[model samples]
Target: MNKILIVSQQGLARSTLKTALYGEHIVIEAGSAAEAMARAQEYRPHLIVLDMDMGGENSAEICMTFKEHDATSYIPLILLSEQGQKDDIINGLHAGADDYITKPIDPIELLARIDTHLRTKEYFADLEKSDLLMLFELIDIISVTRNPKKILDIIVEKVSCYTEVSRCSIINIDIDGNLAVVASNDLKKNQKITLDLKNYPEIENALITKRPVVLEDLGSNPLMAAVKDKIKHIVNESIVVVPIIKKQNVIGTFFLRTVSTLKGDRAERMNKLCQIVANISGNALENAVLFETLQSNKNMLENLAIRDSLTGLYNHQYFYARFEEEFSRAERYASPLSCMFIDIDDFKKVNDTYGHIAGDLAIRKISLMLNQLLRKSDIAARYGGDEFVLILPSVDQAQARSLAERVMTMVREVSVPQLYGQRITVSIGLATYVNKNYTSYEELLHYADAAMYRAKSAGKDSIFVTG
Candidate 1:
């Protein structure tokens, strides 16, 4: 509830003023300037009503004292003057009284004026609370995610939801001065669009000035004249562009467009909020950029560790790790698992006739073929020079044989440009673990390898199977 203080020398006047504000406010009364000051300091009232009819003391001087004092300066003061006391009202106003009421006070007018000031104060308080809440939420988002794009997208979405704008976007400017929409509430996921700087003069101005630029009217604003005709069909009524600065440089902008014209406190509140958000965004974007760089480098290093650099397939170590996991899963589920060992026939001949580079090219081509033919559940990796391994889960002997024949057919069709139209073939050994006595993945792989040598002894291009 709001608090009101009434100061008047006459006890009757104080009672009258108290009655006027009764029930709606917590009213305190004092009969002298000194007592009023003491009561005001104690109560910290939202408003003060001072009757200028103090017989001896200077009421205007008292109002000025209250206005000048740091503790009471923010309190709204209403001066009550006798009828036709124009000089007194003028003096009270000049002494920093917020409003005036001529004697024979009307209760309705008193309530209306007081309510106006209170409402204005409340509006500003709510705006402050909202701004703090938004900043807290943005900080939370930054702490939880390392993906810069995800962070930018969430920021734009939250801003749009809070501000109720027609469109809200985060634009990034590259070192070459190229502008792109990095994240926007209006766009699809992962969608990005390049922008022509000339079309967005407000954003350009904000960048150039390293400050905010607001276009209240798109049609009449001089900054938007170049694109007025181009955007005639757009429904946006205003635009606000705030530069995101980092270490004295403009990295990007927060671009907002509204369908309704913002005026008075609405406009001021929006501009203030945008400026604050831009400030927070500067630091948030910097952290996100750094985090993204580190994350990218970490991923690249991990990829190198687990992948074969030459053929882009799983390396020997990764294959063994995955094979053991798959084998355990198949054993636990009582599911069939097939292992295949493949040796390229006469691979050394290609290297001798052409070069090692040609041999590497042939290996890459075969790897690509294997990748294309394998199911999502199948795993293929280059085991060593001229050798490849495969793991097919839930595949029995018949299915394994069918897959081996398919691989043989594809190998015959493979042609390396470096080989000068020389066709390549592979000898594949297939083993199924359903009825085999193998106790470990290594035993299964060894059996497949031994079967591959038997196929080699039988002929160069063939398939050998063992349980």
Candidate 2:
């Protein structure tokens, strides 16, 4: 059962409605808008029917006043009049009438309109509840995924469709007062209104303040007026900008607007849905920040694990693992390949005179020199203190020796800035497997190691190879 106030001055219209709605509802009759307003405040009716032709002088003005009134604003209003033109109906609708019922109103049609509007109001209420539930689910999803951009994408996609909005954009402000266009939906991307936040100071202020900024019309809002004028072709009608807030700090902004004025429950839903997106987006941003911090630490640890601390080349373990891969590849393809072992000659004498710091610098210098001289196919690794190794594929012993000699000469010529006058010599051992001659990659490395020691034993600053 519902409470309804009917404002029909015509005796005929009043009698018919009262009898029709007698059993189902508490029906109150008011002869004019003044009486209707009085009765509405006193009774708090859920519905009001206002006659356009005889609604206390100016029916349109009365309708507006009724809507503006705090007591009757929430109650749905029905406008009845003889003027049933499309413009008249539109004006009535625009004047805060929930529905427009013309003169000589059909009892069945009139009742149906009432039923329909009431049913719609109930549906909107249900939609609100469902939206709240969906919003909670959205928050959970955002919290778990920890991806702000992805969450924004979902927000624009799901929420805009639910609310049937034209487009959506989320603008994030950085510390320097500049803003970045962080995320937008598919519909938003093609939108001509490119909200390049960099140019808008008002949006920045709104974002910084963590407030909801709604521009019912760009032409009216002073802040948007100037920017709107510049890009008037793109920005027209209503625009809603909700600040993304978290922990009492303004992180960013979520923008929702349309080329046309968004009206009724959809308008309320749009504004609220934008706020909801802002709330969850803020959380997602926090998680994303924390996630990036953790990933940075993890990446640092991974780099340390695989890289030599001194020379920053691949460590011995990493080298061996990659060597097995490259060797297997070469063996399968029967491609020519080469491996070279290098040891700094009289490294102790240099370390003793120049100190450990200088020894570290020397290792780094040699590593850089070798890296610069080697081909992209070659992999260089620090085997141990003052020792390095290289795995080169598709090369014969002749080519390997030539590359080794070139590297050795380059190392000798490079001026170690700190050890200006001191000469740093190096001994090298080179081996190659042009065909699948070796049993495995390990045998090739073993042969290279023996050759390196031979070079060291024969004489310092010399090259050795196993036939």
Candidate achieving the largest lDDT: 1
Query: How many steric overlaps are in each model, in order?
Result: 0, 2
How do the residues 1-467 of candidate 2 rate in per-residue lDDT, one tens digit apiece? 88878987888888877876777678999997778888988999978888776733777778888899998888889887773254666777888987776555455445545654564443445346657766777777777775556776666666655555565666654322234555556445433334455356457545433355565555556777557656575355555677664532222334433223575555665665665566567667766755755676777657657877656688888899989999888888988778899999988777656544355567877888877877887899999778999999888889889888897888787565446478888889987886676878889999998899999999878899888
Error of model 2, residue 235, in angstroms: 69
Best TM-score goes to which candidate? 1
Please provide, for model 1 over 432-452, each residue's C-alpha lDDT reduced to its tens digit, 9 standing for 90 to 100: 888546789999999999999
In candidate 1, which residue ranges exceed 4 Å CA deviation?
A: 1-298
* Cα lDDT, model 2, residue 456: 91
lDDT of 2 at 336: 78
- List per-prediction Cα lDDT, in the order shown: 0.77, 0.70
Kindly give the stretch of ten consecutive residues in candidate 1 with the minimal lDDT sum. Answer: 248-257
Task: Supply candidate 2's per-residue lDDT for 345.
Answer: 93
TM-score per model over all chains: 0.38, 0.37
Please estimate how well model 2 matches the true structure, expressed as its whole-model Cα lDDT: 0.70
